[model samples]
Target: MSKTEKISELKTNKTRKVAFMFNDELWQLFKQTCETNKTKPTWEIEKWILNYLDKNNALD
Candidate 1:
């Protein structure tokens, strides 16, 4: 398969939605962390949560 085909296959293989509640203070902290790390706040938070789950073997 072509690179695009492979990527598309991967994208279609799985999906999930994660929702949570956070106060303003927590959101500010997350935004600051993302800025300090030079990453988009939303993307960084999602990545962090995913990594945490993976490390804890909770992705099942």
Candidate 2:
């Protein structure tokens, strides 16, 4: 499938893109670590957010 098609599918699945600003060095290290662990940065961030919400009883 085409890249555009894949992106469209993601959008249709109710996923939204999020952007963040981070220290360059920290961002690089985090990305590299995730790569080394065979994981995506988004997955890690999602897990962290979910845990934070759950801990604070803020989940919907």
Candidate 3:
């Protein structure tokens, strides 16, 4: 019933972490655009991933 064991038992969801680097100015512009549209950067990245997968016929 320690903290580490409790943490391990709580991890019931499956999700992968996606990461990458971006140019400073371009990243700032992208964040500003998403903010103007009331969207988050993570949501935009997820949409881009889905579109890429569909375009490449990689989705199951």
lDDT of each: 0.69, 0.74, 0.72
Kindly report which residue pairs in candidate 2 clash with one another.
none
Candidate 1 lDDT, 1-60, residue by residue in tens: 654564455446657766778998988888888889889876766567567765786554
Question: Which model is ahead, 1 or 3, in terms of lDDT?
Answer: 3
The candidate that achieves the highest lDDT relative to the unseen native structure: 2
- Residue 54: error of model 2 in Å? 0.6
Query: Which 10 residues in a row give candidate 3 its minimum summed lDDT?
Result: 5-14
Cα deviation in Å at residue 48, candidate 1?
A: 2.6
- Clash pairs for candidate 1: none
TM-score of each: 0.46, 0.70, 0.68
Model 1 alpha-carbon miss at residue 32, Å? 1.5
Over 4 Å off in model 3, which ranges? 1-14
- Candidate 3 local lDDT, residue 53: 61
- 1 Cα displacement, candidate 1 (Å): 12
Model 3, residue 53: distance off in Å is: 0.4
Off by over 4 Å in 1: 1-19, 56-60
Ranking by lDDT: 2, 3, 1
Candidate number that wins on lDDT, 1 or 2? 2
